[model samples]
Every structure is written in C-alpha cells, then in structure tokens.
Target: MTSAIPNRIRAYLGWCPMTGAAQHPAPDQPAGAKTGDLADSGGSVTGRADRFMHLTIAVVVLSYVVAILILPFLPEVIPVHWNLQGKADGFAASIPGAFGLPVIITLVTLLFILLPKFDSRYAGFALAKDIYAIILFATTGMLLVMEVIFLLIAAGYDLPVITIIPVLIGFLFIILGSLMPYIHRNTTMGIRLPWTMKSDDIWKKTHEHGGPLFMAGGILTVIGSLVSGIWAMALMLVIIIGVTIYISVWSYRYAKTAG
Candidate 1:
C-alpha cells in the first residue's frame, strides 16, 4: 500500500504545471507592453516626473472642488466639525459656497480638456476628458448630498423623496463613466486581480465582459439609489465587487485552458 501511495504522489507531482492556459506574448512584461506609440512621440512625456505632475494636478483640482462645495453651508468663515473620535476639524467653510460647484466644475473640466492635448499617445485615449466629465457629474451629486445633509441639520428638512432621484441618476452616470477608460485599457487600473494581470488575454476578456456588467450594475445602482435608500448603494457595491472577482477568475481559467 505504501508503494502504491508513493506512485500516486509521484504521478500528481509530475502533472503539467502550465495548466494549458494560452501562452502569453510575454509573461514577464506587463499588459500593454507595447505602448510604443508613447516612446516615439515628442508630444508625450513618459517619464515618472510627468506622471507625478499629472497626479498632483488631479489632487489640486479635486481639493478645489471640495472647497467650493463645502463653503456655502458654513455658518461662519471657519468650517468646524467635531467627530465622535475626539477630533476637531476646522477650515474655511465658506470656500465651497464662494466658488460655487458649477464654476469649479467648469474650470476643472477645462483642465481635463487641455491636459490631454499635451500628450500625443494619450491624446488618442483621451482619458482626462472622460474623467473630467465624470468628476463634474459626481461633484454635482455630492454637492446635492451636502445640501441635503445641511438641510437635515439646520432646517429639519428630510430631503424630498423625489429630489434624490436625480442625484441617484447622476451618481450612476458618474460611476459607470469613471470605469470607461479602465474598461478600454489593461494597465494598473480598475480591478487588477493578480490572475487577470498575469495574462493579457485574461485581462482583455475580463474587461470586455466586465465593462458592460459594471455599467449595467451601475444603472441598477441608480435605480437602487432612488428606491431603496442607502442600502441600495451597498447592493450596487456588492454587485460590482462580486462581478469583478468572478470575471477575473473566469478569464484566468479560460486563458489557461485555451492556451
């Protein structure tokens, strides 16, 4: 019996390790390895320095928007908040009101439009433009939420049952739109499960399927947002996370089998 057991273990160990997944163009390289369009273009900046600049700009714009949205609700020049965790936070509460969300959005949107023109390779993908629109819409909804919260605090307004509908719709559009660029590309964004990143085909297929799934889920999220209240947001989050995981695993297995 011991000899038989040893033979069985040996057989198992000898099984093929590759598992039949389709062999990628190069396993060691990241997905979208070619980005060759970027290398030859004078208009594009591929250095880490350029990337940092872009990220810094994005953060600044986001901060400016937050300030614009929060200032109008402040009773004084200073925005103050006391948290249950024993922290006091204070800022210029009137900043958001002074800027007005619409004005902030417009300025940010202009930046998005102009930033893409700076790069030749990225000019084609135009992610900045899309992100700009998504951020604007999202900011609008967030401003509305802020208004609701303020009303609840100062006016005892429960936030009309119907006013929330538009906010929900706006939120869905924002979420779905935010995923678009990532849905279109395969590098360092939007649900980077290890297996999916390991195989290029898996990344492509998963995103191809996941893009639509997430969009649909986002639409449902809008519906849920207006109908079921906060719980709806929870459900939408679950669906997005769950579908992303499922597709990642499926794509990995499928690639392995096809290869």
Candidate 2:
C-alpha cells in the first residue's frame, strides 16, 4: 500500500512514521547531552535567533541617529505644488532635518524590535533578519527622498524628483520583504494577513506563489518611472493595490480549505 512505503522511509530516516515526531535521547544519556537540545526544539531555538535580531536593530537605530544628526546642517526648505495639477508652486520649511520625521521612524522601528520580544506571533510579522537589509535599503531610500526634497526646495526647484524615485524604491523594498516569508519556513516579518496567520499551509502556499507576483509588480512600478505621464503613475498605483488585494483574498481562500 502507498502508506507502507512512507512508513519504511520514515523509519530509515529516524523519524516517527505516523506523526513526524523526532527521536529523543535515551534515559542513559548524560545530562550534558542536552547542550544542543535547545537548537533542536523549535521554541528554544527562537532565543538564539533573537541575538541576531538585536544586533540588526542596533545597526538600524545607529543609522537613524546618524541621519538625524546630519539633517540639521543641510537645507531647511522643500518645494511643493499647491494643487493636484502641480501648476501652483509653494515652499515648505524642512525643520531641523526631516522636521522630526526621522525621530518618528526610529520610534516605530524600536517598537517593531520590542514587539517580537513579547509577542512571538507579532514577531512573525516583524522584519526577518535576511530581509532586514532590504528594509534598511528602504530606509535609506526614504532618507534620500527627504534630503533631496530639502535640497530642491533650497534651490527653488518645484519638481517631484525626490518624491518619485524614493517612493518607487520603497515599494520595491516592501515587495522584496514580503517574498522572503513565503519562500522560507521562518516567518518573523512580512505582510501577514489574517488567513496566513490562521493556517500554516495556506500561508506557505499563498506566499510561495505571491512572492514572485509582487516582485514582478515592483519591477513594473520602477519601469513606470521611465515613462513621463500621470497615467503611468496611476497604472502603477492600480497594480500595487490590485496585487495586494489579490494575494490577501487568495491567502484567505487557501486557508479556508487547508484546515
């Protein structure tokens, strides 16, 4: 029978054939034998992972601090269009660098770091270590946008140059971050939907498929930058929103039956 083959294989692999249970050490084994036992247990292994998490957060916090310090010495103004048509011009003062925007971001980032220590489920939604680099990239892009806005304003340029590229890069960062959770077993940071949170299988399947779609969508958004028109921007927004909704719905349906 089909079941007999898998049972045999599981036995050969030293795993429980029926429930995928791991073989434990014998009673005769010394107490010290459990040194690496924590690594074997899913719950305990999480502690080791936290070390890396703390280190990453430290670096992120440092970057924000440096930006906050450097911002004040730079420009103090940014240009903006008064109307939707972007025809009327206006200037907005950049207060002490990003006008305390970096402070707000740093606070949010710290909150994200602390959230995982208390709530592992929320940690699942926190940015994963592997994806931390991308999140940082997004942060860097945002800084560029902020700095560029100040510089342009000081120069009296009313263009949306800083806004366009940074926003595009930020979008790519989210798309990239979202993909890692689906591609891997560990889930400590991503766009975790209610469905994905409820059923592991549906979460895995939906992410496995959704990751690539978001990546493609991100690439398209970047390309949208090349074309000079409002319609292109509108199209990009539509794609981003549409793709997000599609993945959310797909994840929900997949979870509904998986249980």
Candidate 3:
C-alpha cells in the first residue's frame, strides 16, 4: 500500500504537478496524447507552469543549503522575535531551529503548487496558470528573504528584522495586487467572498477594479513600513485594513448587481 502512495499522488496531480497545468491536452498535440506529454511539449502553458515548479523546487533546495551553512555559526540562544525598534526581544537555544523555516517554506511552496489542483473550480487553474506561477514566485521569494533575515539575526547581525518584514510583506502585496486582475475565479485563493464567487464575470470585474486599489495600498504599506517612529507597522496595518474593506465593499456592490 505504501508503494502505491506516490503513484496515487501523481495520479491526483494529473502529471502537471504545478497547479493543474496539464488538466487538458494542448491544441497542437494529438487528441490521443496523455496528460504528462504536455509537460515536455514546447510553447504550451503546461510546459511554462512545470518550469515554474522546477524553479520553486530549486529555491526550497537553496533554503536548506543556507540553513545548513548558517547553523554552525548561530549563537546557542538566538533571538527569535524582535521589537518594534528591531531589537531582539525573544530568544531560543535550539540550533536546529534554523531548519524550521526551511521546512515551513518547503511546505508553503508545495501548498502553492498543489492546493489549486483541489480548488472547487479546479479548471480555473489552467486559465490562470501564469498567475499561479507569478504568485508562487513572489511568495517563495519573500519567504526566502525572511529565511535569510532569520539566519543573519541568529548570527548576531543586529539587523532591523522587525522593520524589514513589513516592507517585504508590502512588496508581496504589491505583487499580488498586480496579478489580481488576471486571476480567474477560484475559491482557494484571491479576494474570495460570497459575492465574487457567484459569477465569473463578477470575479473578473471586481478584480479589474480592485487590482489598482490593492496596488495603491501596497505602495502605502511599503512607504508606511519605511517611515520611522509613530509605529510604522501599525500604520501599515491600518492601510491594509482600510484597503481590504474598500476592495471588499467594491466587490460586494458589483457582485450584488451582477447577480
């Protein structure tokens, strides 16, 4: 039974392995071609998404390598948390703690790649394959930055870890904002709400209008995170909250009429 697990997983993934990339056959291929065949086929969406999966795997592998190299140099008790002023406010003595983030990010990468396969509207993934690839790249790339920051702090770099995290998060939001308009309807991710999920047209419209607002908010977040004093992160939090509410209301209003 154990031996069949991988096969089952591969079967479940439908040979695309990257966010439902090959669920349907490519046009140029013979109608009789298998799903896995598209992964190797040039100029196809499946081929592009599969390449993204490969890069994501490489990032995860590099994270592990970084953790291994830095573990030896980290202090016995390193700061795990930082204060508003970027001072170390918490500590832990686990040397193996370094590997924790690598493991987490590995799982996160998998989640980004695999979760879309099971999306209630699973077919949506194929239409938004590029969207998935870009989002995955942004997500793993941000986590990689966080991973590096953690290690550097553990090695006593006296870095502004707290201040930097929000900026990174802001950039991630910016990336998501840019991609929102391109996203097809999917329940597993995006600005999913009861209203937006009702229709594909509603989803597209909401994203088209909301995408710019989100980008504006992300810009504010990045700016707010950079400003010193008066709790920069708090300002970012407020901006994020305000932007979300605005976007939600817009989507809801549009969806109400759309329905």
lDDT of 2 by residue, 122-147 (tens): 32332133244334444544654554
Better of 1 and 3 by TM-score: 3
Tens-place lDDT per residue, model 1, 84-124, is 22133534445443444445445654565465455433422
Task: For each candidate in turn, give its C-alpha RMSD to the true structure in angstroms.
Answer: 18.9, 12.7, 9.3
What TM-score should be assigned to candidate 1? 0.44
Higher-scoring candidate on lDDT, 1 or 2: 2
Q: Rate the local accuracy (lDDT) of all candidates.
A: 0.45, 0.50, 0.71
lDDT of residue 161 for candidate 2: 54
**Distance from true location, Cα of 102 in model 1, Å:** 14
Winner on TM-score (2 vs 3) = 3
Ranking by lDDT: 3, 2, 1
Tell me each candidate's TM-score: 0.44, 0.58, 0.79
Predicted structure 3: lDDT: 0.71
Cα lDDT for residue 150, model 1? Answer: 39
Q: Which 10 consecutive positions of candidate 2 have the poorest summed lDDT?
A: 17-26
